[model samples]
Each structure stands twice: as structure tokens, then as C-alpha cells.
Target chain A: MKHSTNRLFSLGAIVAAALMAGCVPPSAIKPVDNLSQIDNGKVIVVGKIELTPELEPDEQVLGSSYEEYRNLALVITDTELRQPADQLGIGALTRRINAPLGDNFFVSHEAQPFFILRSWLVMNAEIKVVSPNYVHVPGNAPLLGMFGIDVQPDDRAIYIGTIRYHRDTFFGTEKVEVIDNYQQAKNEFASKFGEQVQLRKSLAMPVMNN
Target chain B: MKGWVKKTHCFNGLTLLAVALLAGCAFSGGGRSIDDPTSSLVFGYMDMEEAPTSMDYVKLQQVAPRSEAGYWDMGTDDGIMYNQYVPPGSFKVAHFGGSSFLMGEHRYSFPTYGRNATAVTIEVPGIYFIGAYAYQEVDTGFFEADKFSIEPTENPSEKELLNTLLTMDWVEGTQWESRIKNRLAELQ
Candidate 1:
């Protein structure tokens, strides 16, 4: 009976996992660095983003220049997705990007501040399977590439790590150089994200309609 | 009477086996990678305008209004963190068509810590619980490698996420990925 019960539980887990994360056959679920850490590159892309009005509205951390008005976080991580608003016991979800895409997390706050409503998701390297969950997000650094860090001034991918907890809080490590790379990304992100800013604003029309 | 003794002996043996088996699968995986299929990690990234001076998160007592930001702390094992008892978000990092242990791989989180260009390693394997808190500058601390010691992290959590998802990890590279993959398959 105990053995059977265990089997039943395992089956349930597989089924439930399938439902939550679209039907990726249990076998297709590859092993990345973390077992539970689903490889977003394959199954999904792992990047979570939020839009918040800095107290100064003009203040930004990860951006290369305040003129760029954007910041890129590196999220050097070692944790799991906790709860909504990020509490514990929640299925592990994160905005951690190990191998980022050109469009991994481009946000046009200045161009489409309206479309800047808060949202989060996990995707594979392809940027496909974006599972966006809406929540009253508070704050998190995108792999924190703090400004003035030695990070580059041109477009580049900054490598960062973190130990995220399902419980909203996360811990990470970053370097001045990487922050610079992210800053570079920001420099270009602002320009690139700016082009789409108008369209992003246009997309938010429906929300405004409501 | 003799037959009863045989059954009792068998029962004891089974119990011992059960303990060993249960304990055998106690340890598991961490992190994620994209280009490297060999890695075992899955995480997201965000872009911020300004770095947070002091970043902290709290649980909302209710399903907060858009006017506010902060996480709601309802405790459960799975589903959208916003959905009643659902997990964080409804997304799946592909399960490597492996086995039960692989499934286990999908059930944990591993974080790496160090200054840029440094490697952190966890030499042993065991069950460790994680509790997150802001540390005094060192600014952001990744529970230093040596800090991965097995301890009771008195973090508040619902029975499921704590028991099922947030099982901790401290290992070399992302080896936990394959370790958990093989482990999860054994059960099936």
C-alpha cells in the first residue's frame, strides 16, 4: 500500500506539473544546472520583469546613463521561485536569465510607460512559451547591474547570479564589469526599446479602454 | 506461531529497506543554463532603472490592488502565486524526458555565489532548507559556499512549497541537475 501510494503521488506530480507547465512530456524535461530549475532555454525563457515608478521617477540603477532611463539586472542567483508576491511554498518561478536572448527582457518604460504595467514570466532560450503572471509586484533588480559598475557602455550581455527564494526575496552577486555590460545593454535597450515604445503604448490602448 | 514469526521478520526487513530507500532519494539539483545542455539551471532576468538601495519583500494580506506592489504571502505547493494555492507562475522549464529523479530535478532551486570569475562548490550532499533575508553589506550575500551547511531555516512557508519546491542545494557546478534527473526516474 505504501509503495502504491508513493506511485500515485509521483503520477500526480507529473500530471500537475504538466498542466501548470504546458504538456512537456515528463521525459522531455531536461536537466539544466538545477533539477527543479527548468532550463528556460529549452522549456521556456527565464526572465521576470516589473515596472515601478522610482521615487525620483528619474532614478535608475542598472542603466548605463540616466539618459537611457533603463537598467539591466543580472540576477546572479542561487534560489527558487517562492510565493505570489513571492512567499514560500509557491512553485519555484523566477526572472533569472542564464543565456539571454536579444529580446530577452526589453522594457520601454519611457516609450510605453502605460504598457509598463507589472508582469513576470519564464521562457526557453527562444523567448517562446512566455507564461506571464500578473501580480502587484513590488521590486527586484534584473540581475542587478548597478550603474557606475565597471560594466561596459555598449550593448552586451552581463552575467550575474542569484539565490532567489519563492518568498519574494533573493540574494545575488555582481561585478562592476558585468554591470557595465548590462549598462551597455541598457544604452542600446533604451534606443531599441524606444523604437517600440510607441507601439507598446498602442498595445496598452485596450487596458486603457477598460 | 512459526509462520507469524516469519511474517514479522519480513516486515522488519521491509521497514529497513523502506528507510534506506526514502533516505537514498533525500538529496537533489540546482540552477539552469541555455546554450549548455549540460547545465541544470532555470531562472529569469529583469531590467531595472535604478538599483535598489535596500531591497526587501513582504507578503500581502490580500490579493493587492494594482495601486500597490509587494507580494501576497498565501502558502501552498503549486499554481500561479496569485491563484489560490497556486505556485509562483505557471511555466515549465522543460523536463529532460528522463525519469523520476529527473522529475526531482524539476523540484528544487540552486544558487551560485562568488565575486565575478570565482567558482563556488558544495562537496557533500544532504537535505538543506533555505530562508532568505537581507544581509548586512557584503551588500548581497549568496549564503557563502561554506554556509550551505544543513540547518533548519525557520522560514515561514506553506507545507507544500517548502516541502516540495524550495528544497535547497549546494553543489559543484550544476551537477545537481543530472543527480536529480537520475533520482526522479528511479521512482517511476
Candidate 2:
């Protein structure tokens, strides 16, 4: 009886770990340590994500909380926004931004233009009783919500402005706005990469309204 | 005795979870014979460079006629033919791919933007041909990500497909032959 009980407990733990593994956050891009890292046909893209009425520790429970934002990931694709972006696809790249709010940057190959296909968030309540949930802004319709950023061949640093997500009472995305805050973003990039690295303002604008 | 009962309960719970996960890969309904051809049906041909095996399938998502918004999964025959009894509405090729021993699972989504997007509207569908497409994988690099392109092409014409259907046992006595012929004529 004791042996059987031990086996059952071991099996349960493995299953739980496998389930949790799917929600494990993708690795965040490391901040640039030197100027040469952004060289060699590579460009640094900077942006910020803001979640209004952020998730609070008290709201972490089994049921739905005030806001379930845990990890926000921006999916970048190489001129293939016609179909929905598959983060795992070869042409697609994902940069995970730490939850709630902060400035983030990612390095990309310079020659090819990139588009911010969409943003998806993983909602894992701090308490471990429940599994994680996912929420995608723009909810898979219209397909015109993609933002395009064109990088010039010689451009070293590009700032795509700030993306603000407004959540409703049910935590569904009520609205998404791309606001130009290039001055502050420029300052942040300067402080990190130093004043020598030129920060170019290339705010991402909505491609179409359809 | 209490430990034994707890072990059994735990085993049952794990079994249920495993079953639920595996159920997602179950074959979606495809190639089922339709009694009445007059009912709505959507059919298409996919000419893949490397044909998909029995493990592969395609999916269509109904976008318009909001009342019937849902997905239809259609398994292929020789990775070429796919037919489903979809309602009369606007549908889009959401994605298509399958698992293989060597390649594992791969899915390619049709473009949802620009002119190359894959979509068709069946306003008054007896039967609708969504067009023939050529699917090819783009070689990015050895260690680079996999990329693919799906484009519309005119090959294995509608008449040829109609002739092929006429030979099938399912279409012999039914109205499918005439319906497909009519659809071809409508396209002309």
C-alpha cells in the first residue's frame, strides 16, 4: 500500500509539472551591454507596454481576478502579417516583456522590415492552485490591427513608441492605442546604450482600419 | 485500505487528464458522403510539393453569417482533396499541417492580409470550389526557422476534378457529379 501510494504521488507531480511547463515564460532579450552588440546588420527596437489597473497580489486567487496580466509577449513577424502570426513559426519572433509595465528592447536583423503582429499575455495567478490562462488583444478579428515598422538599411536604433492596453471589467481588452513617446524612449535608450548610439524615431502606425 | 482508495482515485484523475490531452489530436470529420448535394459543401485541392500523409489535415474557419461561426476540420486524401459540408458563408483557410515521424507537427497559415489571402464566399452553395493552391516550403537556412508559402494556381482544372469525382463510388448514383459539373460551368 505504501509503495502504491508513493507511485501515485510521483505520477501526479509529473503531470502537474508537464501542465505548468507549457506556461513557462519565454526568455526575455538581454539588455545590450556594449555598442558593438547592436552593429553588424543588427538593429535595436525599443518599446513600452502599459497595463492600466495592473494586477495586484491580493487579486491572486483561484477565480478570475481584477486583472490577470502576468507576462506580456510581443510577436514580431517578417512581412507576413497576411495570416495570423504564429509565434513558433520560422518567420516569426517573440520578445517577452515582463508583466504590468516597463520599457523593453529587442535586436533584429536590419535589412528586413518587421511588423508587430499582435500582443498576447499569460495570466498565472500568484497562487499555484490554478493553471495559467491566455488573453490575446484584438481577439483574432479584422486582422488589420498589425503595426508596421520600416527600418532603413543604416539605422542602428529604432523606437516603436508605447503600446497601452485598456482592460474592461471582465479583463478583456477594451482598447489598444499606439502612442508616440519617442522623447522619453530616446532618453531611456540613450541612458542604456549611452549617448553615442543614435536612437531613430520610427513610430509604428496601424496599417489599415479594416 | 485508505491508502489504497486514495491511490485508485489518484490514478483515475491522471488517466482522465491524459485522455483529454490526447483527444485534441483525434481525426476531424472529412470525406463523409453527403446524402443531398443541394446542401452546402466546400471543396478544394491542395497541391503540396511533398504530399501530406494520413496524419495531416486542413482547417477552415467560418467568418461571416455570424450565426454559424465555427471551425471545420477536413482530413485529406493523398494530401490533395478536402471536402466538408460547411454552411453557406464566408470561410477562410485558417491553417494546414500535420505531424510526421521525422518532422513532428507543422502548420502553415494562409495569409490573412493583402491580395494573397485565402478566402471564399459561398452565397448560394450547392457546391463551391475554393480554388487550387500550390504549397511550398521556403528554405531559410539549416538552423533558421521554417517558412512556407501558399499561392493560388490553376492546375488539375475543375473539369479534371469533376471527371475524377465521376469515377468515385460515392458520386456514381448521387447528384454530386451533376452538381460539380454545374459548379464548373458557373465558374466559366
Candidate 3:
């Protein structure tokens, strides 16, 4: 009886570990060394991502069981606006940009039109059950959250403007706005990739409902 | 006492196996045939650029409006038919796609908040035929992301679909024949 119980407990532990392993987040794209090296039809998407009411490091230490925003990332897809399923076989063409709470850049290799489906933030709390708490920007208003920017094959660099995401509270109503700051974006691109690289302004705007 | 312990172990193992199998069947996306006329059935047709290799190649997602929970329904080759027993609710085609050796896997999400959002309401336990659609591949740069566009098509007419349903073995003797005919008449 003791041996059988031990075997069953071992099996349960293995299954739990397997399930936890599947919850690993999607890999973040590493910043490229040279924008010119991002050739072969690849385009560099430069933009600033800001989250208002920034989270403080000491906030999580204050309470043992409070949901606090941990990380913010942009969910970009090729043509559609949907979360990519984490499964085997042919899946949706989706990429995640783990942008910091400030100015950031990511590379888009797909020449097709890319859209910022939504910005998702991970909220970590000391809950009894192990689960993921994902809070999307423009939470209940998906239409206002979608922004589209076309990437051309010959384009070397594209500035998608600054994305400002503000939330009233941790799990409150959120709003997203795309601001055009091409001049500042151009200067930033020059500082990172040199002045020779031309940063085309194709600001991402909310997709029209028509 | 040893035999009793062995029997307990066997029973526990069998229970675990049964649970695992049930879980697998619940999420496998396998649809039911025309077995019950009282069952709420959702039928649709898709015209792909290339024929799928298997009957279950293409799949569609039906989502409930309130809870937003959903399931996948596998499609058949007969006019790209998708015959599934869906619960009676206000559901929509969230997305549909399949994989091919050359084109890889693709999914097209139906717009939810625009003029083109799919709105389907299954109010009763009857067969419903969502409109037919044809998949068109959009041109993209080399090694770039693939794109597809869907358009409403009317290749396999209602008459043709009714004839095909009548020929299916599962529909031959079942009340599904009258149910399908009645539903198609209402559609027309």
C-alpha cells in the first residue's frame, strides 16, 4: 500500500510539473545590433510604449497577495488581431515584443501588414492556485485598441509612433492612444542606428471600423 | 491481503486511464454526425485554394457571446462541410483555418466589433447553414508573413448541398433528411 501511494504521488507531481512547464511565456525578440543588417525584406519597427501609473518595485513587497503589473508586451500579428495559440502544428503568425515601460524597438521580419492587436500586461499575485493573470489594454473595448502599420519590402525602418496606455487602477478600465512623435522618433533612431538610416513615418492609428 | 492490495492498484490505474481518455475526447475537436434531428447543428462550407488532405483538416471556432468560451469543429470535404452539434446560443465564427504542406497553417479571425462582424444566433434545436466562403491568399514578400482573405461564395448551391446531405450514409434513414430539407427551405 505504501509503495502504490508513493507511485501515485510521484505521477501527480510529474503531471503538475508538466502543466507548469507549458505556461512558459513566449520568447521576447532580442534587440538587433544594426538596423542595416535587418535586410532581406525585414523591417525595423521603432516606437515608444508607456504605461501610466508606473508600478513600483516595492509594491509587490508590501502585500503578499496583491495583483501588481509585472511586465508589459505588445502582441503583434501578421494580418489578424488575435492571441496566438500555444500549440503544436501550424499556428497563427504572431510575435511578442516585451517592450519596457518606455521607449523600445523591435524587428518585424514579415513584409505583410502588421497590426498591434493589443498590449498585454502580466499581473502577478500571491494566489493559492497557479494561473496567469493577463490584463489587456483597452480591456473591454477591442476596437479602440487595434492599431495597424503597413511594412513594405523595400522599407528599412518604420516609426510606429508612441503608444500611451493608461489605466485608472490595477484592474480598472484602461485606455490606449497612439501619438505621432516622428521628430523625436527620428532622432532616437539616428542615435541607435546612425543618421544614414532613414526612419519612415508610418504612424500606427486605430483601424477604422468601416 | 496481497491480492486485495493488487486489485486496488489495478482499479486506481483503470480509473486514471478512463479519466484521461474522457478528457482527450472532450477537447479533440471531433464533430458528431447527423445522428439526432433534435440536436443543434451548425453547417458551413469553405472553398480553399487547395483541397485539404484529410476530412478534419479545416477547423472553425464557434464562440458563445456571453462567456466567450468556444470549441473547434473539424470540416469535411463534401463541399467543405462542417457538421457539428453546437449548443443553442448566440455564437459566431471567431476564426477558421487549416494547414497545408506548401502554405503552412493560417487562421482568419472574424471581426467582432466592425461592420463585418459575424453574428449568428441559434435560437432552436435545428440545423443552421452559415454562408459559404472562399479563401484567397494575399501576396506577400519572400519569407514574409502569409495573409489570406475570405469572400462570400455561392459555388455549391443550396440544391446541391441538399442532394449531398441526402447521399450521406448518416442522413439516409435518420430524420435529418426532413430536418435538412426544412432548414434549406427556410434559408431560401
Best by lDDT: 2
Model 3 lDDT, residue A120, Cα: 49
Model 2: per-residue Cα lDDT over A84-152, one tens digit each: 543233223234333235556554445456766655443322222221211111121111246778788
DockQ each:
0.03, 0.02, 0.02
lDDT leaderboard ranking: 2, 3, 1
Off by over 4 Å in 2: A1-210, B1-33, B36-38, B51-57, B61-75, B94-117, B141-145
What lDDT score is found at residue B84 in candidate 1?
Answer: 19
Residue-by-residue lDDT tens digits, candidate 3, A1-210: 001101122222222212122343543333565865675667778887776656456322112322223444444444665543211112221365556667566554555677776554443223222222111111111112667887776787888888876654222226777888889878877887898868888888777421
> How good is the docking of model 3, by CAPRI class?
incorrect
Candidate 1 fraction of reference contacts recovered: 0.03
Candidate 1 per-residue lDDT, tens place, A35-80, comes to 2332222221112322222112332222221221233322222122
Least accurate 10 contiguous residues by lDDT in model 2 chain B: B1-10
lDDT of 1 by residue, B1-188 (tens): 00000011222444444433533132221112212333322221111112211111112121112112212222221121211121122121110000121111111111211111111111223212222212111222353211111122223332333233334433234444344444445534
Query: Candidate 3 chain A: minimum summed lDDT over ten consecutive residues — where?
Result: A133-142
lDDT of each: 0.22, 0.51, 0.49
Give the DockQ-based CAPRI class for model 2: incorrect
Question: In terms of TM-score, which candidate is strongest?
Answer: 2
